[model samples]
Target: MPETIFRNWTSDLSRDWGKKPIQIDHSLSQNELFSKDALAELIERYPIEHYSLMRTSSRGEEKKIWRRGEVGGLSGHEVMAQIASGGLWLQLRELKLVDKRYHDLLQSIYGEVEQRVPGFDSFNHEMGVLISSPNAKAHYHADLPGQALWQIMGRKRVYIYPAEEPYLPQEELEKIALTGLESALRYDPEFDRHALVLDLEPGQMLTWELNAPHRVENHDELSVSMTTEHWTEEIRREQMLTVANGILRKHFGVSPKRRSTEGAGFWAKAVLQAGWRRSPWYKREQRKMMPVDFRLAPGTSTTIVDIPAYVV
Candidate 1:
């Protein structure tokens, strides 16, 4: 069978802008485009391949992973012990293994999103689409690249804090060039951080700066959503450093002295510094980096200028 490469709705937008999060609700204004019936049928037709699931648990004050990999596989049964011990179970890298049929569905809806939003683009498949099982708990984490999350079914509340806060302090953007992002968020979970908790229904979307400190609390019922990565130079650097850190951690007893892009990159870290507290760089960067500026108005188009040559 031949595969279809659908038209790229975001090619123009990708070329002109850098990544930033913007919300667009009416991209699929028609009710039929994202109905509960359509979502349920899709899930039933394409059962998830669970080989990539990873479970993390708390052992006293610290967290640990009890089991990982396939459901019936050796690691899968071992996870039961961790669950009994009250460990958290979750999945990662979902888009990599989803069935091709869903790819068609994504492409179908993606076109409408691009047209209606004016300047949005589809994410790379490696970033994957994520849907939470009922009562799922996603520990606080961030991504290497900016993320766009479109809610297809069910409900979930998301809480986010400003990436840069005075108390949090931006020490050195260069630190990201050095430890990776995941480690940075842990420095201040209790800092005087500003928070926004979102209650999302079907068809709502939230796009935000990558590495922005955030977490998810899903409803007791099913929650289905899709996510994609918008590539950039920073993302490329983040991926390389994350891999480098993993290798060094395995081969040597020492942790890599580089930033991991998993959540909140070095820029967010540096913004924590006292000098940056006085500088205008953070706000200026925010305005310049956001790719699309959209409104609820119908029949509008957006265009960004001077996107770096490297991004796709």
Candidate 2:
């Protein structure tokens, strides 16, 4: 482990932490845990419920394709090799709960942040490692929690757009809060014109404003990255408001205007959202599991065999 996770921290970085899209140099790429061999070992033993293996469309393709798949009996190295071959990405989610080393690393990263930024306390911290194929693209999406992307290996181009209006409308965010679908936001190619585009390399990490809409495209090489998510009291309150407002608009056919996070309106909406969570409707409306449509071929590195669709 490096003595310092962030390499080029400055007063400006602390000031702009979550207010805008900022990329900073980091030392995690030097950590031995992120080495290809170590990652392969982790993947081999990772719990099925803690990971998501997805196959998506290649770059420049008109039609979009996203399917869930499984690793089957392949070795960890084989899985990495398959991803490197193209059109696939694996997310080892919630690393803190899956591995103790990662749990400690997560704590260390946040501990350093709290030390640098006074009064910025965050909780519900989670980390996921993403291994992606060459020329793979993650379509435009917006997340509810505070997010940061850290590049450990390879390179990727990231486009970050403002977290408002056509890029990330409030209703779209509200729907995500209710349905737990991050990719529900609509995207326009013209939005790229106003986006802050940056190419991320090893040892670099990017953080943007809360709920900012962004997309990623991998260079013609396999990419490895870590994504971190956290929530603060303010963020929790905003989420409550989003859910409550969504319920009003979706279920009751009522439009909510106030977006305050305090006082009577906020408390009332918070209570409403809490009640909605316990209702039968909430259970039915939650995101459904994606069926496993394919599995890695037994001995072939890049071949995937189609399987009878089944939910894991």
Candidate 3:
């Protein structure tokens, strides 16, 4: 259907699967979903809970997001025209849940990993599509699950940093996993020196260890990328521990010293998080949509209409 999702795998993949950064070749960029017109229509029809649109500044060293929007019946060309001018990013997340092609791709990936890598059996998988204006940036961030970013269209530069200490502090990771904030971290210029930077192109795929810190900058063209996340039992245990430790940090004000995934200590912490997550006190993390403040006029990028109320 797509040549093969994972083009190459090595014995090293078994040992370094979730402990280091790796880039491989894939053919997903040629899929119909990545077509500019097709993508625009999909974003317009996407559910409010699964998609996001943000207005970003074109000029600023800081990635300042000026406003966010809720999608309605915006056409494919209209959305592309807005991005073509270089000021927006649209993230359609949990795409596998909404699209069968994405679902098949993920299943195929897992099958390949299972057949090649040792001790690898993923239980859960989720994927998303990231469409951003030329020159847009993802900002430095880390995800909770084992993650792989499959490049679909356009070119971009990526920087991946270590998952420990200064790059990804424990406190910051806890905050992201528990709160409603964007998957972003406070970035310092010094950290760039240690980053494993890569120039990503269409048909290429890159993945790093679980919770690795990374960021991206798009080239001068409309960009389309697929982000896939999966969790094996071992990875699930790590998540359970991360949440448990977060409870210890935020509730008891204790900075944990050890990162153990199993034992009596681990089980106790797991139960604490499971019970706490089920309790009424734990609020689910959900982002309230920013009002639909602007609309793009047909065939033009700079012309935006200020709406009086939320778009439907």
Candidate 4:
């Protein structure tokens, strides 16, 4: 990694680490991972359980899951080719946990981050690479941690909304974090009036207020980007709080009045989480899978096949 990366970092580094959305232009190398061929190989060789390829409309409203095997005999390159020539966003998720290069990259990025912002060290960091077809949209969503999107190739527009209710109610946040589902929230186009939209190009990246509701839309060309998620000590404690509060709301049918992670209420909720999550019922609930109904057809941009079209 050359120091040429992150050339756009601001002098006001202390104020911009995660409290607001900031676009650092010229912040990444497009080839930090490897060449296009290498990316195809990585996409192919990546574990089936770890990757997610999905087909969707331009606004990302209608969605159907796509699997590598659906793309002829060669799942890796075929999936890559499909994404390059067709319409999809293939998320090779949790790369830091699966591949060493990615793990090192996360550590390296944070090393830089720690230097820029004093007293800012993140834990349980998760990283992912996203490849998307032209005009693909990532519907409005939020995550449970401090988040950032680094663009490596092509262009996209990101809409960051206010981190408030109606946009993101507290109960929904607790439910999303507790259920282990992708944090997709209800999207109302009306909210666009209140959004701060940014156009991202290669060599630029965006980080926003933690847990802020946002979404993405790619331009007419294919796009590749890296996404980082991490929890601070305070953020992790908030996770525990979300979980504990969720249990209080769902199981006990009691509405929690306290949202802070510091009181006797927090202690009670934490204990409840410790006991409730230990049950087999909770384990079973976590294992439930959403249906994968379709996959992108081989060698095409818009074609898709029914789930019965493939054997595995």
Root-mean-square deviation (CA) per prediction: 16.8, 1.6, 2.6, 3.2
Model 1 / residue 78 / CA error / Å: 19
TM-score of 3: 0.90
Candidate 3 lDDT at 98 equals 79
Q: Residue-wise lDDT of candidate 3 within 103-124, one digit each (tens)?
A: 8877887888788787788877
TM-score of each: 0.48, 0.96, 0.90, 0.86
Residue 115, candidate 4: alpha-carbon lDDT:
80
Query: Which residue pairs come into collision in candidate 2?
Result: none
Put down candidate 1 lDDT per residue, 158-217, tens digits, no spaces.
Answer: 766565544222332223423344434444556424566788766677767655656776
Off by over 4 Å in 4: 32-34, 58-72, 75-78, 290-312
Q: Which stretches of candidate 3 lie over 4 Å from their true place?
A: 60-63, 180-184, 284-291, 308-312
Position 290, candidate 4: lDDT: 39
Every candidate's lDDT: 0.45, 0.91, 0.79, 0.76
Q: Candidates 3 and 4: which is better by TM-score?
A: 3
Off by over 4 Å in 2: 59-64
Per TM-score, the best of the predicted structures is 2
Which candidate order results from sorting by TM-score in descending order? 2, 3, 4, 1
Full candidate order by lDDT, most accurate first: 2, 3, 4, 1
Candidate 2 vs candidate 4: which has greater lDDT?
Answer: 2
Q: What is the TM-score (0 to 1) of candidate 2? A: 0.96
